[model samples]
Target: MKDRIALIGLGQMGLPIATRLATAFDVVAFDISAERRELASRHAGIEATDDLIKLDSEAVIVVSLPNPAISRSVLQQLAPHLHEGATVIETSTVLPDDVREWQRMLEPSGVRVIDAAVLSGVAQMEQGKATLLVGGEDAVLADVQPVLEAIGGAGVERFGALGAGMAAKVVNNGVAHAVMVVLVEAFAMARAEGVALTDIAKMLDREDGGLQRPLNHRIMQRMAAGDFDGGMPLEAARKDSTLALAMAQRSGTPLFATQAAQTVYDIASGTGLGRKDYSAIAQLWEGWTDRGLAYGA
Candidate 1:
């Protein structure tokens, strides 16, 4: 029989991971909203319920929550119910130290904790293309590789020890956001200075004399196509940006452009563009400068 798994939090990230897990395991899921659970139950292997108490003592518990406090709350609440051999997989975007602390808390219950941070957003998770960064004992992760494979269709990379995966994810996302803020601001100025976005696109297309990365192609293509809705939403991006800034501050690293970029996202999120893609920062530029670079005006 396939091992039983209990998935908590059926929001954007949770729903996709739960649905995907249902394909390979018998999944029992919980969400604060009935609608989300109803939506998740459409999958073949899902059994949605409202009771956290129904989680089996031996069930592998996978949590995809919004923040550390919530993760700790759920862990504390579920500790007694979890079986001795069960594992709790945390996939939230949080500090690596948070995972270490969670592990320490759960240690007495004999329920193991693993830092399994998902490195992509809702759309990617739905398509089974999300990447998983795992940090735990080698033997524990090895035993759960199948579940990781089911959700992180691209692959899983085990960094090392208890907190490494979270650190890697935090840094990776911080760098990506920092770079995007630069792109948004620079392109806005380029359009303001009377350079056609088409001209800039042409320059970027050439491999020889441009800032080159696969992300450059994706963001440009998204701008050219005017399809920014399905990517990482602005609110989520803003949260990550703030977290990134905090992470930088803690490390005493004076990061450039990150705060300015985060401010842009803050404005966009406040103006009811939270559900839109992070690329929609270009819209904020259009509003401020009365110029067009992202949606081609």
Candidate 2:
């Protein structure tokens, strides 16, 4: 007989993840929505239910609720019914503390909790191309490796203990979402300056240009090495930003992200980092928090 997997939540991401898991295991899918339960029942190798009790016998349970509150509520209801030695893989985008709380709540009953944060969308999950940022005991992960591989293909990375997966997911989303807003702000400035959108896009897409230069080339390398000596100095970068702001003002373009970024360069310049590499702006955070970002710091 095939291994049984209980999946709670059949929303956009959850539905695709459930279908993917069904390819390798007999999935008992649950949802509060009658429509979703019906939809899941139609899929092969899936048994849909509205009851949490039906999930009790499954050795592996995956929770993919919308938010922390709903995830907490559903897990609370299901916790009492979970049999000993059952492992719960939580794929919700929640805080690291939330994952720790769930682990605390479930440990008394011998129920293991693993934060398996999905790093991609529904389309990726359906295609088994989603990356799973996982955190849990090594032995626990080893036991459920097959189920995770079934859903994420080969894109599973275990960060550390229980809450680390959620931490990685949070950091990844923070960078991605912030960059998206910065891109919009950049495009607005470019459009205002009469620059062709396609040309701006191509320029940013270049490996030796804007985007890759900071991430894959000079800036990250400089930051990682803590070697903010004599590259394009912070003073020069500040001057360039000043010129961009001036151009935006002339074209009546409101710059939010760029303007905010300029404040960082201004602060760094004022702190006598003007002669250091422009990436020294990153040092502001470390200085403020009394933390270190460099490899040996």
Candidate 3:
């Protein structure tokens, strides 16, 4: 029989991961929201619930959540219910030390914990192109290859041991956040200096292999349409970047750029842009430049 799977959490990222697994595997999914569960059932073919016991029988259980606190809470609840030898995949981006600590907690129960952090955006998961870095026993990883293959259609790299996967994910995302913040700041500055925002972005696009064009264009469209309502909320980015700093600190290193980016993001989140996309950081720049970057109605 195919191993039973339990996917905990149905937030923006978790919902999609559960949905993708459910299409082929018999999945028992859980979320705090009946609305989210209903949405998942309708669109993803998974049986969603709020009960924790439903996970007891699942051999391969996955947890996708935000922050270490929530992950710890769920782990405490599941530790009792999880069967011996059941493989628990921790896909949340968290500190390596936390991952190691969870491993210690699960060890006594005979449950194998793997720090299986997902790479690429949530959108990439839909296309089965998400990369996975699995950090745990190679034998256990081989045992669960089917489930990992199902989720990571593109590739899965099994790092040597626990916490390695999360370390890679943190470094990768830290760089991405840094780049995103720099782009936002530069565009805001160009506009302030009376350089046509569009033209300056176009120049950057041409010189930078058009990497910023899509992002710049998206922001421009939103600005032009006066619909600067979302992209990646500054608050979430702030949290993730903070996560990066914490991870770096633990490693006895410093991320100078990430720190600077965090400051700008802090300003946005402080003023209620916490729910808005990270792109909205540009608004903070507008405030400093005393210019209206707001476009469109």
Tens-place lDDT per residue, model 2, 1-297, is: 228899999998899988999898889998989999898888999999998788888899999999999999988988888878999899999999999999899988899989999998888887778899999899999999999888887499989999899999999999898888788877888998789999999999999777888876454588878888878988998999999889889888878888899999999989999998898887998999998877668
Model 2 earns a TM-score of 0.96
lDDT of each: 0.81, 0.89, 0.78
Q: What residue runs in model 3 are displaced by over 4 Å at the alpha carbon? A: 43-45, 189-297
Model 2 spans > 4 angstroms off: none
Q: What is candidate 1's lDDT per residue for 1-297, written digit by digit as tens?
A: 238788989987999999889878899998779999899988888999898878765447889888899888977888877777778889988899999998888888787888889998889999989999989998778777888888899889898998899999998999787677666654664555577887877786676434563356435766556667777787887898888677666655555686776788888888888998777777777788887765446
- Best TM-score among the predictions, by candidate number: 2
Candidate 1 vs candidate 2, lDDT winner: 2
- Candidate 2, 234: how far from true, in Å? 0.8
The C-alpha local distance difference test score for the whole of candidate 3 amounts to: 0.78
Displacement of the residue 150 alpha carbon in candidate 2, Å: 0.9
List pairs with backbone clashes in candidate 2: none
